[model samples]
Target: MDAAVLITIVVMTALAFDFTNGFHDTANAMATSIATGALRPRAAVALSAVLNLLGAFLSVEVAKTISGGIVDESQISPAVIFGGLAGAILWNLLTWYVGLPSSSSHALFGGLIGAAWISFGADSVHLTKIVEKILLPALAAPLIAGLVGFIATWITYRITRGVPDRLVTKGFRFGQIASASLVSLAHGTNDAQKTMGVITLTLISAGHLSPGSGPPVWVIVSAGTAIALGTYLGGWRITHTLGKGLTKLEAPQGFAAQTSAATVILTSSHLGFALSTTHVCSGGIIGAGLGGRERDVRWSVARRMAVAWVLTVPAAAVVGAIAGKAASLGTGGVIGVAVVGIAVAVGIYLASRRTPVGPAHVVDELYTPAEPTPARKVA
Candidate 1:
């Protein structure tokens, strides 16, 4: 392939990954609000989509992290990056299919790391930066958000203790709209920038830009548009999982979770930490459930999600390595990888059609009660 054609292909693939990231992480912003009936599912996503676009222009700190920080960009090729994106996109789809709220950010990191390691060597992957910027934040951001959410929930309820239940619920539902919007914006700040970084890195590798150059305006605009469009499509499956599967949420709990998560994500973005908004939001939901003393926190479901989180990086890495290796072969290899990726994507979509989860069904699971287990016989 011509250098320009290859670069164009890689850039398009990056945008596709950005689109997947948008839908995959939509639940991170609007799930709780939707669950609590704070905003209708469609309205919530529309609002999130707009806010995410605005947030993309807010800061380039995280973009810098991706363009220059993670891997030795000098040592990698556009094809390797394309393979990395393929890995992240496939992982995002697989997890979305299973209704697990895994970290799209981690998947991106893992894919890049795997591709770089396979293409060049271990030294090409930045260990310290990964640990400091990616790993540490992944573990801590969620915990911090969870704690804040728990306390915030406790305080919110305590302040409204004497208010009528109806009034309390109404007020908090309104509050959730604002808080959830903030989360959406925060998500844009962090998640959208990852794509910008990747595109900028591609430009640098292709000799269109100098190393350390931030994302150009065109890159930012395209990335933001792709993510916004994806967000509008909605990731109902993951939204359903976070909103209802992790814990049942009331309006106050929803408010707390969104507020806390937004705060954590915005802070991290400002500091250039490529934190997982999904992790922070999940933690917030769990914490909010705990805050409501009467609510049940389903540890079984949570444990399943935790298992997925643990496996996200390594799983994506393995797939990324395979894809990267194949792409490194030549033009025929690139074409082969693209064909396989498209086929896999198409298969997942076709399979999903058999048991569709759309906006109509997004909240149905939340309202439906689980069938009770049969009573035990007397011994």
Candidate 2:
């Protein structure tokens, strides 16, 4: 394959992953709103999709972080990046199928590191930048967001304790609409930019763009549109998990969760931390559960989600390493990797048809008795 053709393939694959990121994460922002009836399903996703598209343009800090900071572009070829993206897109789709709200950001990072390490060597990877930009944020963002959500949810109920319960519910249901929309925007600002960064990094490595250059306007537009379209499609499986599985979302809890997640995500974006919206939002959901009452948290589902979180990076990394090795051989190597990626994707899609997790049955089928077991402790 021509290098230009390979670059185009990489860009398209990145966008495809972005689209999955959008729908897979729609639940991260709007699921609570929908569950609490703050907004209708269609209306909520539409609003989120639009705001997500708008949010993509708000900051290039994170994009720069990915394009130049994570790995040395000079050390890895665009083919390696493509293999990495393939790993990411696969993991995202797999998790989405199972309705686990894992971190797409981590998946991407894992894929990139895995591919780079396999193709070049450990020396090609930027460990310090990874620690500063990716690792530290992964450990901190969710905890901080959870604490904020717990406090906010507790306060939301405590202050309204005197008011009629029905009145409070009605009022906060309205408020959740705005809060969830903000979270969606924040999600766009952070999550969508990762794909833009990856695609731009691919271009830079291919020598199509100058080193240290920002993502081009077309990259932004395509990424934004891809994610928005994915959002419009919606991810019912994860939405069911967040909105109803982890805990039943009431109006007040929904409002508090969305508000806390938005604050954490927007703050991280400003600081150029490409934190996972999935992690932050999951923390908010758990916090809402805890804040609603003593021991209200569903430790079981939480455990399962936690396991998924722990495994995501390593799992994606392994797959990326395999693909990157295949891609190292040359043009034939690149085509071989692309073929396997497409084959895996098509196979997953076909298998999904038997027990489809679409918008129609997402809510009803999600949180069913058969979902994975949640973890209780780190050990």
**Cα lDDT tens digits for candidate 1, 1-379:** 6788778888998999999999998999899989999889889899999999998999876445463467787667887888789889999999888778988878887887888888888888888987786678768876888898899999999999899999988999998898888888877877788898888878988899998888888999999999999898898878988888888898999989988887877777677664678888998998898888676788887887888888887777787888888888877777888889999999998776655677755567543323332332110
| Cα shift from native, residue 65, model 1 (Å) | 3.7
In candidate 2, position 154 carries an lDDT of 88
Predicted candidate 2 versus true structure: per-residue lDDT over 4-116, tens digit per residue: 88888889888998998998899988899888888877888899999999989888764554534576666667767877887888898898877889888778877878898
Per-candidate TM equals: 0.91, 0.90
Clashing pairs in 1: none
Error of 1 at 288 (Å): 0.3
Give the residue spans of candidate 2 off by over 4 A. Answer: 59-62, 67-70, 127-131, 271-274, 360-379
